[model samples]
Target: MTILDRLTGFANPAAALRRAVQLFDSGRPSEAFPLMAMAARAGIADAEYRVGRCYLEGSGVPPSRVEGTRWLGRAAKRGSADAQALLAALYVSGLATSEAVKGPASQRLFEQDTLGEPDFVAARELATKAAEAGSATGQAVLGYILTRGPGPMRDADAAHRWYERSAAAGCAEGRLGLALSLARQGGLAERDRIADEVRRAADAGLPTAIYLFAIFTEHGLGVAGDLAAAARLYQAAAEQGLPSAQFRLGLAMIEGSLGDLDPVAGEAWMRRAALAGNVEAAYLLGERNVKYRPPDYAEAATWYRRAAEAGHQAAARALGSLYLTGNGVARDEQEGTRWLRTAATSGNQAAQVDMANLALQGIGEADDTTNVAGWFEAAASSGDLIAAFNLGLCFVKGVGVPRDEGQAAQWLRRAAEGVAEAQYMYARILRDGRGVAADAQQARAWFAQAADGGILDARVALAEMLLNGRGGDRSPEAAVQLFERAAAAGHVGAMFALGALHSSGQGLPIDQVAAQKWFSAAAECGHGQAQLMLGRYLAKGLAGERDPLASRLWLERAAAHGIVEADEEFAEATSG
Candidate 1:
């Protein structure tokens, strides 16, 4: 006999398989897998089933669902009980429909037979065939169909009988379903017994069973709570690339519920889940990137688009914002409005607020005050802070609403409580006695708060008030400190104020040298007043030697920049 024939022990087929099974049981599925493949090729029924199972589970190499289904189909046709059960299970679970199943013949079957009508008759017939061959998984699948009735073949009694048989054969899913059904129907004692059987089946490697068991362990359902164990089970399923498990594991890592939170690892898991087409993961990744690390705007936009495509309202709004602001890509105002409108139609409050702003400003299209007011009202009704601020502006200015300073002040104060810009504007109202009694001390406090939040205008205004004693006590030294800070941050008014302070020696040592340098720097930065002052100092040699040419040049520039006194200075410097 040939060596292959000798190994099979048709001659030695049974003995060879026994040895392969021994190797497989000893964790040597690498060697066992090839031997099983050889036996399968030799038409050993049990070896065919084992080989297919190994391929399906990727026990010895990368998994091939298509190859696994084909081998299982061949073994099942030969009446192998294990193969029949596994094949039926795969079919019922939809895992058997691999890329290979998209061939013309399979497509025809799908379009003509499966898609055309409910075919419980055919499904039941196939299921019965596998069940009759002593396949527990097949019996369980048949039970599920009989209970649910894909067509007109509903029979709960038949379902119970099949489920009982499958449970007796150690099918974990069968036991779990039976237990859940019994629990729903008030058979509490039976439910408890079946739940234990389901646990045993889960321990033996059934993926669905493992997931259910994890849920039970985590929630302490009919068992003591064990979060750690539940986390481990979820991780195991995630490693197998199950999308739900991956999402849950990522959430646990992000929330630190499973231990120390790791944002990087959580982001990795979230990305994997998003790639697997989880809408929630896509939205979460987008939001996280937008809030924390916007350097990944392309990725953030992609995730936002995915969620938006799936009809997530918040994601659509976020995508609109990105498009409007050109966060990670070229700004497209038209596209931004489209997304904003989509989200607004979906009742997104933020989108309504944004739409109002865009409409009022004619940002992406023509101004539509009617639409703007409508969206603003909608946002305000939903308690949007920015919308309230905008509404106040509208009322105060009579842009789209009647002018009403009382209502405006009310809304402005509300927005100001949380927003720096609103705070500064509201402070102006109080300082100027507009619809409120003037309160210099309160105005200064508000200005200081806004300034501390990086509002450059607020800093300059506060510095001016301190320097001139306009709204509060005069403090030139304090004003100089504030002006210097604001000037360094590129505030033109603050630069002029600082130059004046150095030139006048008010609350500071007179330093003509420092004044000339400040004026020159400020003038180079396009501060008109500084340009005029620097030209005068250069022409008169107040700080150093005269440079009429430089002085005349600066004076000409200042005149062009709208400094009225610069024309006369320029003429005088040029004449001298």
Candidate 2:
């Protein structure tokens, strides 16, 4: 038989409890639970506390907070310091069941407050009793109550004295409490001392202390920034079953906040944390799955719905959009809009921007320019870049606001802080002196920014400016490269620019073949001038064998496009 199986058959409850403590300490709590319960049933105080802890945390048993509280109460009445400390915390937080906290009727706050309307008087009595009995946790908790003024008891000076005594007793919670209090009072040197105390508690393996230390390390607050160290601490805390730490570690991996991204590891951690009831982790899992290779929209919907039901506003918006587009579910625009409205009302900025877009496109039941502008304004105020851009356009076109160039420029400037397209728009206004002062140098800077951001129009515009010596220093070679980039991205104007540059040998050796190729590309895109030029090149055999039929065809096409010279050339080519 396994040790636990043998231990369960032992006649002596004391022996069973001893074996359970060994197993539990070795991280095999499942093997320890039955033994602990057996001893607890025989009235062993230590076993009772251990059993209560297991039930409270679902460590090795199905969690039952009520049962946990009952066992803890039994242990506390038997004078177990740990049990009294824990039971006092539950009462103070009002997390104990009504049956467990059923003191005299005078102590019952029957009304349901968010924290279940805990009986603070009872909590104080238990904490005071435990402290008087020399429980370090009890003393530290009593200090916390004083700080937070649980049930009209406020004594900061006494709280400080209690925390000092608890810390002297080697309690990590006491050290953590002192550290938090010191952080509020001290200058930089005091903050540094507080950090040392926090580190001490963390070294003692306090999960909350470790998690806070990780935050301090990651942000360089009162310590040198050490992302690697922060990640290690977070991992340690997560292993201790801290859901928030698990969520943090997952986000760090997914976003590469510490090092190279590891989406697989990130997703695994996120899934675990989500199952542990982390709404943010659930939302991130939905986002990741929605954009994963080949996508798992059904899985995305499931997670999003789960998080949304738990008050994750972004997940609500994502789920609504999925339903609207039928991405992973049936298309039900009415239902989708209802969810969207829910998210918007809950203050999700993206949802507000989405509502603005629907009104702008006249897609909603009450679509109107006024509603569109109002939603856009709300979203913009909440710092949404696209909403700011749309609001700028509305101001410029008087769509939902009076035409105000100054206001348009202001909003456009905010939008321009975000993306390539907005940068290009702002550059256009600067270049043309429209609704803003014309500053050729400033325009060039914005165009360069937009071009570097991979905007084809911005690339072509920047190239033209460089070639013409208008906005910046003239550099024909740079202009040629910019034109080539835009042309590769399928801009017909860029093709024409490349053809002209190659024909004229502005920054490169004359290459008739390259010139003809670029001219042909532009001509096929219905550029009349390019067709006429391509026709001339074909007729002249500039790059290869003459093709009379091809030349005549191009000339006729250009003439049809209103190129007068191409009409004359067409007449000449066909007249023979």
Candidate 3:
């Protein structure tokens, strides 16, 4: 095309650029693009920036990052503030695209024409220069870099300041950033301001702002809750390729919050979000696959692995479990341990307990017992009751450290808040004054709790305390009931205690026959005291007709079990 036709008779490059901007403002990018390109070729910096944006977004031409970046570089080199800000943003985002040109030539082009490959340092440098030159877009980009770019560069206060400046300058992205900052501060006034800023930014067509506004509407944050309106806004942002928005819409559809339950469509949206690198979507897909009626274990493993590779701790733990059990992948202890360790090291409490158990079983590494205790402590610090109980045992028994009953009591007491076994152990500590002052009342209380949890030992201990009134008011009736219950469950101690209670008439009417029956039952189960008592009962005909042979036999058994008095009794029975 002739220059006159291309530029529309505007000999001045600035004049052509102004006409192109007017046309673009009127939504005639196709007509404006050629004129903008003409002005760019004539070395107009602002026109070069406009042409670059057009190429980048494919406003009036096919999208090409290579050409777009080239034009942006030209404009940036000529001191175009807008070009500098946009180029910085692209570099910071790694120019995300599967279609990005690659190879040595592409690398050279990126290095020479676009600063470098995803270099945050260079991005920050360009954004700083542009922001200092008073570009609203530059200020917004700089604010983003300060807010979420890198750990070392993050400065929330500084980011808020930059966002405020850019928002005052009328940048929609800046308004969105300012709203996010205000949301974090979290007050009635801040929420109201956030609502206003987010709405304005959404009106300006910012996808992230639309997504935020939708969340606010859905949850009634400084706005009336409206599911339908939130769903519509989610649809708009999702269609714009916002992964979080897509995930939200997917959840809404799956939960029937979008008028109908559409699992197929919901899952499709989730898959799209996952493919777009949404880690939570990937993790959720893995969970769904595993929870299906006929679980797709192989597919679950695949999805879990994807999220795990992206540093999702729950996904790593799930993938590790599958690998360890051979549920989806081949059983690979080394591989499973590696993944479990990955999550454990990242502060996943359950994963830490898993690793400790594996070590205890000698299933993974041949680590010393101390390593197991260390893992338990790590999880215990995060309020894991099982880990706390385990760590307490470790301290009490010196299995993995120096025996320290005081430390054991501390941990076990904390664990006792929820763990039945810990309650039982803590009760023992209280009863014996092992690590703290002996408190019979506390011991009885904890034993009762553990007994209710089905602990046989705790039932016996609590029954004894009740019968003796060691902790509170004596309740022989309650004691007898507890003993009977434990005896039914095959506890030898409870059976022997029941025999004593019957013999003493403590909880029921005195009955020699019942005593003899209970003593014989406990004796048969290897209770030495019960054996001796049973022998005496049989010899004296305490419950029925005497049987000398049975008495001698019982006495002999008790003697063999280390009951000193039974030896003399056995000799007497044999003589008789």
- Candidate number achieving the greatest TM-score relative to the actual structure: 3
lDDT of 2 by residue, 205-228 (tens): 999899999998999878899999
Q: Give Cα distance to truth, residue 78, candidate 3, Å.
A: 2.6
Estimate every model's Cα lDDT from 0 to 1: 0.77, 0.84, 0.87
Candidate 2's displacement at residue 509, Å, is 43
Ranking of models by TM-score: 3, 2, 1
Model 1, range 1-576, lDDT digits (tens) per residue?
235634564446667777778778998877667667767778988887887788779988557676676677777778876676666566655666433333333433333212123345544665788788777878887888787766567787788888889888888767866765566567556645655765876787766666667777777766778889888887876777777777887888898886668878877888898888788999999888777743678778989999999999899988988898998868998898889889987888778778878766766444445566567767775777788788878777776677888777777887787788878888888788787788888888889888988889899889878988976789988888888899899887777777788788876788898888888888999888899999999888999769888889899999998777998878776776
At residue 24, give the lDDT of candidate 2.
88
How many clashes show up in model 3?
0
Candidate 3 Cα outliers beyond 4 Å, as residue runs: 1-71, 96-120, 128-136, 146-170, 181-187, 190-193, 220-224, 257-259, 324-326, 360-363, 366-385, 437-449, 460-487, 492-576
Worst 10 residues of 3 by lDDT: 96-105
Q: Rank order by lDDT, top first?
A: 3, 2, 1
Clashes of 2: 0
**Cα lDDT, model 2, residue 479:** 91
lDDT top scorer: 3
Candidate 3 global TM-score: 0.70
